[model samples]
Target: MKQRGIWPDEFTFAPLLKACANLEDLEMGQGVHKHVLALGFGRFGSIRIGIVELYSGCGRMMEAKKVFDEMPHRDVILWNLMVKGYSQSGNVDMGLGLFRQMGERTVVSWNLMISLLAQNGREKEALALFHEMRNGEFEPDEATVVTVLPVCAQLGELDLGRWIHSYAKSKGLYPNLVSVGNALVDFFGKSGDLETAITIFNDMPRKNVVSWNAAISNCAFNGKGELGVQLFDEMLDEGVRPNDSTYVGAFACCAHAGLVQRGGDLFDSMIANHDIEPTIEHYGCMVDLLGRGGCLKEAHKLVETMTMEPNAAIWGALVSACRTHGEMELAEYALKELIKLESWNSGNYVLLSNIYADRGKWEDVEKVRVLMSGNSIKKAPGQSTIV
Candidate 1:
């Protein structure tokens, strides 16, 4: 309060800076930095850490690094913040470098590194880091198990996931916390072991929306759409409030099962009965459901009436449906919209070109080829794996 001749102290500025970071108010953060300097608190370690955290939280990695570099002495917490900042800002290389440079690291450091790698699609590297952590005498905690289990699910490394499961059980960590149980359910579901997922779901001491949504999504994704719909009803009957993700999963099941009327009913019920507004994803599922049942006109009408602009995925789905039904004209319309939304995505170009080639439209095919060449869009090689 400059008017009152009072200035905030380091303790006051610390939290104020944190608030600015959370709000992503870079200008206010800079003003607070000046206040810290004016109060002669610039050399304070806690305040410096607060500044680094502020910059990092605002996605200002360079500014965060500058604050970190100016610190004469750094502690474990500072190192953790820097590592987390780089990792979250998509500088995984810098994150890993800082992680390796630490002379001494706490379990939090290890967990952060593993989780960061896993989330960035480096499941293999995440697993290797977990093994390295074990060899370094750091005991795996509940947080570590929760972090690495998803990596196992993504890579379909069921064996590694099982090992983590066994470790969790022996450590008396399984089914106690919903987070760990949710991860186990997702892992089992992704690994094509629905039985185990169901068992874990049944045995959990307490079930949350995430637990139910994970099981429901697993069913929908694994080709058991009818089962997924059944579970959706069960979840609602048991008085669990369905979230957007739950609705998405249920809609996906309906689409896959060709339950057009049922999908429409659920879409209406989501807003009228449940008071949950349908999102773009829900609309996309409706389009797929109608298109799959040879109701392309209805799907097109739904798209035209969508509250939000249809994204590339929805248009891509419609294009795919048109191709399946041999409706070249409709496919061309959807393909044009998809290309406009994602010009760099070569898959859209390739799909449109193939549809034209299939229908003996040589001129259209040649046009697509020439466009691809001009854009330097090379088709990615197709790869398949048998599980």
Candidate 2:
């Protein structure tokens, strides 16, 4: 267009900015913003909103805010853009402050705020906002239900999650909306309502890999490890390609059931069959499975030969296995790696101390205690709940 002498205007600027956002080309987006200013389109509300959207989409919150602050007049869409930018950038305080400053809000505003709060680990506040949204004039939409359901999942708020399920049903939202359906499965799974989770998963008109993962994970969560493995087989038979998370759930199921051979096969096939590389989590699961099955030597070998540098989790799994199987030497080796990765972890010291005590090595146990005292590391107190 520049070569053809067709200069850009405000009408052209919005789409150009949107294209930049879609492509996530921040440099090109900023160049377009400069052109907008030079072309006198800076004063246009739509152009300004587009600029804000471009910056926010690129995770450039400060730049987005500068564009937003300079806007002479702002609309609900602009406010939503700013809130989304801050929320997504993990600036929940700024997001909430901007939200409270809005004189008027659309449903998108409420949903964005709730989603932000829920995503940032403020489940209680997110739930409270949901109540406020319910009493307001606007009705919660599919997006609202999808966003809030995860809060219930995280908090294990079974009752609240059930209510959301009913609401989704009443609104005819589920089955048609795959995301809401998936969220329902996840919520029920996390809340220990495995039966309901499986029911929801089976009832969904459509199922994705996530849906399969949720159902399989719920089986593992309920300690029905074999059942979880079966579900994984069913998922593969149904032709849903598994991702890394899918394997995580599957390996966990095998670990819980002490299905060493099955776990080994699954781990080996991750790269061969699925073209998915085994992550540290997968390697850790294999170690735990081997350790629990009394394959301590194999577990240690697996850890030693892991392609990636063994992290705390991988070493911790081997350490745990060593303790369980009475392999003090391997346990010590694993403990050494654990200390290197997480010297500050009191659990590691405690585990090592317990291992030595189990073998009647009071001197080693005393040394472990002395080390703990010298490092000033204390075991975190345990907590329990009674129903």
Candidate 3:
């Protein structure tokens, strides 16, 4: 603009700075900031916000804080931006500090705090905050419903999730808002209410691929692979084209039920019919399916011939199958692959030791114990929960 003899005015720098922020181009953002200072727009509220946003988006929370502190006066909006920056950058403590300091909290502020807590695995705290928000006279909005619903799902808080569903209905949220409806289905399915989940799915005014995927996976999770297969067939009949996730749900069904031929045919169809290239996850599922079906040689051959590098999940599945069938030689081979893939993971080592012990190979078990001690590898203690 300068070269073209067009002088940049105050309004000019605001959009330019915003562009830099959106692109997360800190170098260009800094250059724009320098230009804003040179043009006497450094004190501009909009420009400062843009600068804060740019630094924050790039994960430079300290720089964002600096720009924020330099402002002549801070408003709730600016404070919210800073809170978001700290939260997203994994500085949850700093975010909580700023949130606590806010004089007036908007719905967005509450949602951000709740989401931040949930993101950091503080689900119970997030739910508590949601209760607090309600006590403070703030009605749950769509964003609040979307944010807190996942927390309910995670904790298996069926009563809370049902209340949220009721609230959404009261507010006329579901059926129109597909996301909330989908989340409801997922929450119900995960909370061991597959019947309710399927009912919700069937009653949805409109259904997307996600709806089908969730319903199918819900059935697969409860050892209803045949029902999952039925769901997939129905999904196809409904013309909802399946994605990788869809295939994954279908393959999971095959694995649990040991439907080897169906899994193999579906694996072929993924490429031949759908044109969706197989990801490592897809390969892992196929390996698991073959292994669980007792076709150890075929499973091993699949892993060895995979175009992508075989991951631990693929090898681990084989090891598990070998352990089940007492295929000592195959178990050893799977253990080798597992160790090669994840040398630090002590679960596979312990599994191999157990396999040897089960076969009365005390020398091999002792060798495994020595290797573990020499490498400083320790198996994580197992924990059982009644719930």
Candidate 4:
């Protein structure tokens, strides 16, 4: 169109800019912005929104702000976009500020900030926001229900969660929106209401891979590994494609049940039958199972040959097994690896020192004490609070 000397309209630029935003193609977006301005299309709200979306989506909040401030009229959608962009960048305060500044807020706006707070560990604030939203004109929607259920669960507000569950059912959110169902299942599962969680899962009008993952994983979370494994098999039979989380849940269940042989078979099936490469979580679960079952030699071999670096959790598991099995040398090695990862955590030094002392290795214990002294590390108390 440009080659033919035909000018592009806001309709043409809207999707183009949106595509740039989605792709994170800031340079292309900038080029489009320049073209939009040159064509005197900047006055159009659609054009302005597209430009803002492009800048904000690329994490260039400053540029997005410049465009946003220049717009004489900003809709809820544009304001929500800014909030969401800041939220994605982990600037929750900025997102909150934007949200508060909005003269009018939509459910999407409330959901964005609520979800942001919930995800960033501000569960209390997120729950507060949900209550605040309840008093407002924009009642809780599907997204609001999904976001708040977990917060209620985390804070042990079981009664509140039950209320939300009822609200979801009354609002017709439960079965229609699979996400709401998934969230309800997860909330109940985490709260140790396995029977209710399963009932909700079974009653959902539809189920997806995520729904299945939640059901299986929750069983694992509650140490119902046998049931979780059964759910995994049931999922496979139902033709749901299993992803990495599915395997993680399955392995965790087997590990919890001390079903080493079944875990090994599932791991083999993941690789051979499903073409799913085991992730660190899968590997960690296998190591945990092996260690718990006294398969130290095999766990050590698996760790040594892992394609990725074994995280501190894996080394910590090995250290635990070494302690249980009286493998002092392996304990030292695992403790050393853990120390390298988190030198600030004083538990590692304390544990290693205790092990050395138990074996009458006074010299090694002395070295560990000296090391702790040099690093100014101290043992943690039984519990601590920020206050």
- lDDT by residue (227-269, candidate 2, tens digit) is 8999999999999999999999999899899899999999888
Ranking 1 against 4 by TM-score, winner: 4
Per TM-score, the best of the predicted structures is 4
Task: Evaluate all candidate structures by whole-model CA lDDT and list the values in order.
Answer: 0.88, 0.86, 0.86, 0.90
Residue pair clashes in candidate 2: none
TM-score of each: 0.88, 0.89, 0.91, 0.93
- Residue 39 CA displacement from its true place in model 1, Å: 1.2
Name the weakest run of 10 consecutive residues (lDDT summed) in model 1. Answer: 378-387
Count backbone overlaps in model 4: 0
Clashing pairs in 3: none
Off by over 4 Å in 3: 1-3, 354-370, 378-387
- 1-387 per-residue lDDT for model 4 (tens digits): 889998777789999999999999999999999998788888989888999899888989999999999888899999998998898888989999989999998788898899999889999999888888888867788888988998998999999999999988898987899999999999999999999999999999799999999999999999999999999999999899999999999988998998998998998999999998888888898899888888988889999989899999999999998889888888888899999998998888888888777778888888887888889987689632111
TM-score of 1: 0.88
Q: Each candidate: RMSD to true structure? A: 4.2, 4.1, 3.7, 3.3
Where does candidate 2 stray beyond 4 Å?
3-5, 22-25, 58-62, 353-387
For all candidates, the clash counts are 0, 0, 0, 0
- State the displacement of the C-alpha of residue 357, model 3, in Å, after optimal TM-score superposition: 5.3
